[model samples]
Target: MTDQTEPVGEVDALMRQAALDAERLLSGLRMFVALGLGLFFLVAVKPADALQEPVLLRQWAFAGSTMMGYFLLGLLTWILSARGLFRMWGVWVVATADTLFVLSGLWLSLMNTGLEPGAIFVFPSAWLVPLVLAFAVIRGDPWVMAFTVAVLCLGLALLAIGGAESGQQGRRETLDLFLSLPPNVMRLAMIALAGIVLVTAARRVRRLLLRSIRDARSRANLTRYLPAQLADDLGEVGLAALQRGSRQEVGLLFVDIRGFTGMTQEMPPEKVSEFVSDYRRRVSAAAEKTRGIIDKFMGDAVLIVFEGDGAARRCLDCGLMLRADIADWSKARTMRGDAPVRVGIGMHWGEVFRGVVGDANRLEYSVFGDAVNIAARLESLTREMEMDVIASRDLIATAKAEAGSLGFIDLEPIEVRGRTGALALSGVAKDAPLRSAGTAAPVSGSSS
Candidate 1:
């Protein structure tokens, strides 16, 4: 049994690890594509112009220098992508390189004696590309986005002001003269294209912001079920898995504060709320610590699920630790002349159907199966059998022999409802001495 189980566990572990590796690979691919495409656009827009003659060789050398700077910027982007670094420093590096490349081209265009109308349009477009790319890569930082927006606005404003100044000097054609012509139409066309790009980028950013907000809310909700580490894993894996149901064996646990109703009856509404809140906090802490998913909270009860024995054992340990903590809490409350609370916990191992359920407006990621039913029944049985903790025969059989040393004692076989086969019930006393195995005893209750 151990041999067969061990291999299956190893295979599952390997598959999970492979999925993580695949995600990292995809992220790297996206980074490369983003950089590569940006570079391709830059090169396509501005081809190096050729020069002739000895006197013009100096001009050629100057043009070559600008092209060299552009290539260097691309090289820097590739290097950053290869390093697999994600930080503000990388954003700054890329932004600086891109700015320098744009400014160099702008300077060359300004110095050129015979600048074509096309060159003027291309120069600003080149600057726009890098600014937009930098903004996209570092959108998480508000400062970066602010800087990009400021720069684009400043650049456009300066162009408008400069055009106005040139028109006023009477050295250039009047603003109206250019506006009425076919070349003016081309200039308007370029401006229209740039406007489209800006609108598209703004829409993209808006969608991204909405997604970020939704993700933050989803994560806050998920933390109710998962620990910080597991929550991070789930987020990295994304919501697609939850949307599509998956088949897997998982350990389910159900816990209820025994005598909670009686305790609540003895207190005022406010005091009852306080007590329930404290109980939830304690149980939630324990569940998260053990990597158990608290599927649902029903009045005074909590339904938790563990992925496997490793997770289940952790949950068991958490339950034991929680019992000790609650005992300490009860003692403190008694010392202060306050009320105490008792808790009943049950665990079972079985295959579960896990997925998102409900309508589009109100969907929830949950687990459903006979395993969940059995775990609930076990919790219900805890009240009848006067046991603080109860587990199924499946859990007991799967548990390591050392687990029995941890105060797990096999109880009598009992038939559960909706099932033809009888099951071996087990119990572990809250304050029982560790490593003591007691005799199995029959339980007297109808299976839930």
Candidate 2:
């Protein structure tokens, strides 16, 4: 049993790690593609004859050198992407390339010989690529927005300086150029428009980043109420989606502190909070270890759910282990003169509909029907039976028979509210010996 379980556990861990690696690799590839395409457009386009003059060449050299540098930077980006370097580094490499490209375009526009203003056309488009890339790569970082704004300002400054220089050369007057006939005025208009667009884009990016950050923070906070798995699922699919309903067999486990109300009354609010936090941490660790999703925490109680039959058995095993852990934890607290805590847990299994339900303003992913209610009742039963752990007959029947190695006892039938038929239940001792001591606790309970 140990041999079989060990390899399976190792394999699952490996698979998860591999999936994360693949996602990072894909992100790197996306950055590379965006940078590569932008660079290609800049490098492939030839300089016009009018801008080929000696004065312009000297100016174009700055642009040319900058472009070549960006090309090399893009090459470096590809190398990092291909090598699958760190995600932060990959993002930075592309960001750097983009900055250089925008800088080069600005330099070229500055040195523009009035004869070929057409060369300035690429600056706006080129700058846009990096701005977009920066938003994509490091949306959380305000520095990306700062850098984008800096680039926009630099581009505007160059255009203004070039326009002034052209005016002195009898090409056109600066203010008149701004108000003059459609073409030159349009060119000036475009430069102004580009700055506005870039700034707007940056603001939009910042807003998007803030929204993402808020969502992440909310999800993190929600994880305290729900299991990490369910929290993540809620973040991805949303509470409304999950509440819609699905038929799947699930093992539900409920755990509540014995005499929790009395304990809280005896302690200060801060201490009560600390006590609850500590209990949650210990139980959550065990549940997560068994791949359990916490549904919710109601006062001193925690609801956990495990997905599959095998997982359900694992959850039951974990729950029993958790009881022992809690006992030890309580002993440690008692030695420290802190209040000791006792928990009663119950497990049940049945087909149920699970989904998210709520209005636009609020939402929650929760399970529905008699199965969930029965699980809650079973948890209540634990306090009455003087047992630390109880399991419904549904859980026992669904779990593989070999699970008997974990030590479960058959119990009398229980009639629950809202359900017409009586349901059989069982009990498991907290002190039950394990076949293997290190198995992780599994998740149990409805996610609500």
Candidate 3:
């Protein structure tokens, strides 16, 4: 059986890389936030005013402990990512650590500021709501964000009730505190609102990230069946273009490896696959240079379509370039002690229908009509005529003045299979002497 491990390994590696990158980002943000919070606490405490309220020392102590805890946690997360352990549930570790730190930081802030009239309390602690929510967003999981918000609300409610009781206030005063509702109710409402906003924002960002990840996966999958450029265009243009069949004049280029079947008959499956893959890669590279969209691959043959203005010219240019590319590729293969490869290509330009085909569950985008058929017939004629490339007279004529400059050998009209009349064809030798115009030059220095 063919090995499937390589592709799976690649995907796993990509996911791990994404996770590690996220961990590193969160770690840096954690350190910055911790340091900022520490400075804020230091400024609020005002060492000069400490003499006036000896209680301020306790506040400073709490702030110091909270900040130090945050720094240590951040350091731990960074080390985990550096050691590559962050890929093993690092998101959860960061989220849990950050959630706890924020919750504790809120409590410490609340206690230090005090609940008494004329003394700061809820506002200082409320600043952390957005920070914790920010952590939720960075985590990129709605459940984690929701969990953080829920725990924070519970913590705030407990702190409010607990602080009022701890003051040893009378039952009436305790009831009055709950009913007053300015700081407590308002603080809870703000937390809820902030949680809603942050969670909504996080969910939106998570959706976008998910879409990007899905798109990447889809592109990877599509490349297996379609040309990379065509797959990308399909994504950009959307399937709607295919759902409605349309006809447009397009340049069709059909490429088939000469003697590929006979050459691979005696080879092992692995070697055959490798050889075909290498040939396809070279053809794809050359075709892409001329803005050709790969229509499909049928066995050892590739069908490419060139649409829009100047399609015919691009198609012929691409064919000449492919001839040069194959020459260099064959030479490199011979140098490496491998069998030299040869290909036959045919170019035709005509109106073809483009649309989606197949059932709803397994729809396919394809092109049809005489344009595609003529291109295939010409490709087959390349072998019978003992020529490397062939172009229909119509394609040459449609290309304007392009065919004349390339020095193509005109041939008599030849009957093609499944067609009533013979097609006027011209042949271009693979090693045709390069003209001064250099139309057949390979687009890139490295053909392989």
Candidate 4:
């Protein structure tokens, strides 16, 4: 059996691309921030405000250089990411650079102000730590967020050596909470708490994104073998819910290409494949048009099930459409000196066990019962009766009452083996050498 679960590697690949896009967006935003801050320092802040002491102007020069470096690096990263040159590992590199640039600006600004190192907590630049962490969140990688927060907290601790008044010993009650070492210690704790929450939220978002991708792949797989509508219903209700099979009255149609084996015995493998593919396409189109569920197709034979109201009538119409289409296709092949393709259809309507079956290791939607068996039996007789379509009397009766009697020839009733009584059958046909000289009578078993 083929693997059904969506691969985790595929999910990871999608997330990697998403992370790249997020990083590029964060970089572009950072460039604007750097540009604005740099311009503010250059034009808005006067020289006296920028340099408390004329001699400290040299330190401010280094700070200004860091800002310029930040802007240039952000722009380059953004461009590289857009061109698909950036890698996942590069996210941590960018995060470190961003934290350092902001930290140096605050540290240098404090240096010029001559405030005790502890006063860095009151500096406006400290708020940028939260913004940096927020950008990390956009990357949707918890590891990146945790790394940025860890770096910022460490930098804050080093800057806060003893954040206390002279001889105060950094006592929590004595030193101003907002300005001193002890309170800012508590503030750092809060920041760590917030980081933890954001990281948790980001992890949850990643899981949800992966689940969405997995579900989409699974739905596509279902559509591959089942009808589009059935697949859609299963997706909405969920496959687990379908594990408990239900008894449903459905119109069952079984069809197989007549003489497929002998006709393709001498044909090349390519031709044989083409013949089967073409045959299925025609039948599927007809089935879809009538809203029939292509329960499954085993090689050249397909078992179709019609559901809901008026299923019997719709199934009959589908069979008729398929018969004529295959006949027309066969005639064209005959003209081309290729073997003609022909099919036989058997249809029945009744209650059947329909739902998913098997253990969790293997599960499939299936339909089986006496009704399904009767349908197959009828299709098998199509060859013996020299007919292209054979349908049960009960199915004909249902369709006739629901819509109107379909165009089918009344054939002699035959005794089906393993059944209690004879089954009244009918057919629509042309001719076949398989027809026996004996009249229609007791017959059992079928190739269908």
- The number of the candidate with the highest lDDT is 4
Q: Model 1, 172: alpha-carbon shift in Å?
A: 26
Q: Per-residue lDDT tens digits of candidate 2, residues 1-448?
A: 0112344575565545443343343344334434553344344433563154454444435544654564465455556545765455444445555555665555455445443343344333344444444333333345655665675566656654453244334344422322334324323433443454446546655875698799888777665544456654565456555666577778888898999898788788898888889888887887877777777778888888777537667667667767767877877888788777778888888777766556555555567667777778888887787777788766766665443555566677877776679887777654554333234333232111
Which candidate number maximizes TM-score? 1
Per-residue C-alpha lDDT of model 3 across residues 1-448, encoded as one tens digit per residue: 1122445676566666655666676676667666766655555455665556444465556657877887787788888777777664657666776666656755654454444432224344455667667767665556667877787777666665564223633334433433443334434543554565456556656876899899888667655555455553555455566567688888999999888878999899999999889888877886778877887778888998887667888888888877777777887888898888888988898889976666544555688998888888889888888888899988888887455558689877877676678888888866665332236332442435
Question: In model 2, what lDDT does residue 119 have?
Answer: 37
> Residues 191-283, candidate 4, lDDT per residue (tens digit)?
554465456547757876898899888877765544575664665468776667678778999999877789989999998888888888887
**Residue range 1-448, candidate 1, lDDT tens digits:** 0112344575566545433332233233334433443444334322332222322233344545654555455455545445644343555555444444544444444344233323334333343344354334433445555665566555544543442222224323322222334324434443443454455546655876798799889878765554454454456456566667777777778888877778788798998888889878877887777767778789998888777537556656665656555666676777778876677888888788986666545656688888889888888887787777888868756644344655667777778787779977778775564221122232221111
Task: After superposing candidate 3 on the true structure, give the runs of residues whose Cα lies further than 4 Å from its correct spot.
Answer: 1-188, 207-224, 243-245, 265-271, 331-341, 359-364, 414-424, 434-448
Give the worst 10-residue stretch by lDDT in candidate 2.
439-448
Q: How many backbone clashes can be found in candidate 1?
A: 0
Over 4 Å off in model 2, which ranges? 1-227, 234-240, 243-247, 268-270, 308-310, 334-340, 359-362, 401-403, 416-422, 430-448
Q: After superposition, how far is residue 251 of candidate 2 from its true place, in Å?
A: 1.3
Tell me how far the alpha carbon of residue 114 in candidate 4 is from the true structure, in angstroms, after superposition: 29
Q: Evaluate model 1: give its TM-score.
A: 0.54
Per-model TM-score on C-alpha atoms: 0.54, 0.49, 0.52, 0.51
User: What lDDT, from 0 to 1, does candidate 4 have?
Assistant: 0.70
Decreasing TM-score order of the candidates? 1, 3, 4, 2
